[model samples]
Target: MDNDTLLMVVAQLGGGSWVWRRSGGPGSSFVRHQALGSGHLRRPHAVASARLGGHLYLGVADSSKGGTSTVFRWGSGGFYPHQTLRAWQRDTHLEFLELGGRPALVLCSAARRPLVYRWSGGGFAPHTDIPHVPDVYAAKHFRLRGSVFLCLTRFLGDAKVMRWEGSMFREVQQVPARGSMVFQPLLLAGHRYVLLGNDFAPSRVFRLGAGGRLEPAQELPAPTPRAFVPLAVGHRHFLVATSFKGATQIYAHVTEDIGT
Candidate 1:
């Protein structure tokens, strides 16, 4: 979605997928695009978009039909199926990012280790797998000091922040976050912070403390929080939180002085 073109792509669990495009300006309604109908996809759980080689690509993860994911190319009319990725099954999330200056996609799975695929000039190919990570719900990637890191979120036990070590990613820090769905890392007001959204416990915010370890910052009373997004307007900053059971919350980021 953008200022000029607005599109909404939906992934359905039982019903198929569809794409809706806005035809007019503000207050206009969205209509289903004729190119992508409901029967085009089956049981898609996640969708992500990326641009590579001056072309826009969309990835949809599904499991009902046995094929793991499908990549679609965007044309002047609408999106069309371009390729299919059949390596992993039952994917929980699909994220697209740049890895080592190349376009890449990370597929998180609940039944197998999370896998990363890199664009190979023509299509995406399997590049590496995150070892020892099973039952992952989502993976968020960020760059720090010219290095790449991934926050692997899980529903049980501990979540880990892994750093790319030239060859593969290794665990740099582990955080105890049972029932967590997203460990989102965000940079706000020139400080690094990570938000842990939990279903069983209160959601926590951690700051990058001394020695690069994440330290507890604050806690929110949001129940079953799913994701956190940073929003800024003019000079004021705010954090928007989405929850599964509770209402969506917006928190203002304020600064206080503790002068000696």
Candidate 2:
């Protein structure tokens, strides 16, 4: 892509290769680009792409027990290997964030604590780790009321919400969950809400209530829900829910005024 077109890259779990497709347009087709991967890569789990310093950086998670995950940089020719994170087991997610005017990367693993790496002009270096965060399946960073917060979804324990306290993130609230996998925060009708998806229980939508707390709003009917994503079309908002064992569902936002 020439920075004007959107591209989607998918990392395969069994083949360890990445397939990329350009967004279809007037003359452009949805043709897949050349697969990217080395022979050493195995069990690719997730990939995250970001633009830093005017360059495209791609972070890929290879979940093999003793394999290394890699970050690739886009250059004139193509994407080239830039950095390597070694000795991670079952790495599941990769996310890039800009914190305090510095580029940072968050890597999550199933068997180890999540780590933060900051860009240091030359390469990404280890910055910090989220304490007591094990079995972390996903992490999302959001801003609320001038404060930045991180939400961690655990597969075996309660999901946690941590707020940035000038230096580091401290736990502010815990949401009881079992087999929690997705915690997506969104704004609907000028209200802050979070969609919680679990594998063992019904998914629920929680809204920010008084005292900065989250209160349950509605429960989804889908079992083993995996992801909840918000989509906006023109001026309307909608939610899409995907489940592991059920059909995908889309819900449109509606409102009604009650007489006082």
Candidate 3:
């Protein structure tokens, strides 16, 4: 809510990998915080999402033979305590969810079968299992009118939409998402919008409507034609973080509300 145009640089330090996030503010060039995570032998274990209970969950695609996952949960004194889950060590994929007034996260295999995990009195526990679909490439969550929705794209180049019915994620009926357009599967803007990037076509904003979907909410204006840049979103603002051509420039997602 400050300068509205802040550039952030990310780096890995001393076996520490962090996402140094910055935003511009008054009298100050930037406001920044580093979301740090533990390092693995080959790749650093990083948290992908955090819950309202103050839990920071780390998600990684465990493709390596010895790959593992570590998720941090908020404990006493506002610090995230690490809780390592060995079940996801092989091919676990992670996504955050807030369904039915409870903060949760979605876990799946590289095969793309989905499972819902909600924070309980004891760390995080399994809530539900989504239908099995192999080789799923991307998954995202969104909400409308207090209902939770989930959308995922498959490796076969298609998108799947599901809605939480106070119990589990069920396939949406009578909706049309090709499952082809969802490419990168990254959640942006505080975990409410789905960003299309990587192999995702149209590389734009996909909002969850009555159900989980990828309908365009906004089309980002590019200063120049480019590709292969990292993207992130915050609430109504979408950031196109790209180091293409060797410079980091961030863009904001806006509709008519930007200049206001």
Candidate 4:
């Protein structure tokens, strides 16, 4: 690791957000660094971290009525509030990605279409909007064959797969995902897969199939899963899933050689 300090920001729905830092190497416990927006933050939904110009920045999104999201920039002393973004009271996710080789942020909301903001040397500025999509719970980006794609999870309707063209993103695929909350795309064992988590149904996994289309592959018992993270140790692969109403599950990836 280039830096010895690891920073994590936690967002709360009722309380404010907090920044925790861990110094030194492995097994170092994290310590609370600072608390922010104690009386102002309400129903914070998500927190995102990014590195720009060798500096770390953290953003928190809130979904309560009249709530606003805030971005903090790290300084020599500590992290301080750098910018405030409008959350529209229904923002559900904050995603940091690279768009056109520049740092960008996407704010997904249930109230309206998702908005894209690009870093403008000093702060993030509105760049575009993902039109005609509403009630989105989360947005995740993945790269395939030198192209970037976005998977959007909808709370009411079908989930969508969007491809980024020169200037904007266009819908290319849709999966029936009513009541879905998370659509996480990950690369595992040289293959690409997407996990769709639903509140009313079993979570489904889709693999990248022929012609770059997503094909249904398997199902998991994690209902109302919020996130999926892929991990590898030695020659084994694992997947960690967090559920909203159940215990967190860890799954092993085993390849079965079925004779043709």
Top candidate on lDDT is 4
At residue 28, candidate 2 shows an lDDT of: 71
Off by over 4 Å in 1: 1-3, 34-40, 63-67, 209-212
Candidate 4, residues 62-115: lDDT per residue as tens digits? 787778777888886477778888755577788999988999898987687888
Ranked candidates (lDDT, high to low): 4, 1, 2, 3
Model 2 scores a C-alpha lDDT of: 0.78
Writing each residue's lDDT as its tens digit, candidate 3 over 1-260 gives 12244434232324544443344354554434544444541343223655454343444433335655556543332224365544433443567667766777776556436667787755667776777555554466656667666766554544566778888877773222332434333444444555444332334555644445456765543322232233554334545545323354466544456674
RMSD per candidate (Å) reads: 2.4, 2.1, 7.7, 2.0
Give the 10-residue window scoring lowest on summed lDDT in candidate 3: 221-230
Q: Against the true structure, candidate 1 has what lDDT?
A: 0.81
Give TM per candidate.
0.91, 0.91, 0.58, 0.93
Error of 3 at 177 (Å): 8.9
Candidate 2 lDDT by residue in tens digits, 42-115 = 87877888888888888888788877888988876466788888565788887787777788888889888888
Residue 50 in model 4: shift from native, Å? 1.0
Q: Candidate 3 or 4, higher TM-score?
A: 4
- The most accurate candidate by TM-score is 4
The clash numbers for all candidates, in the given order, read: 0, 0, 8, 0
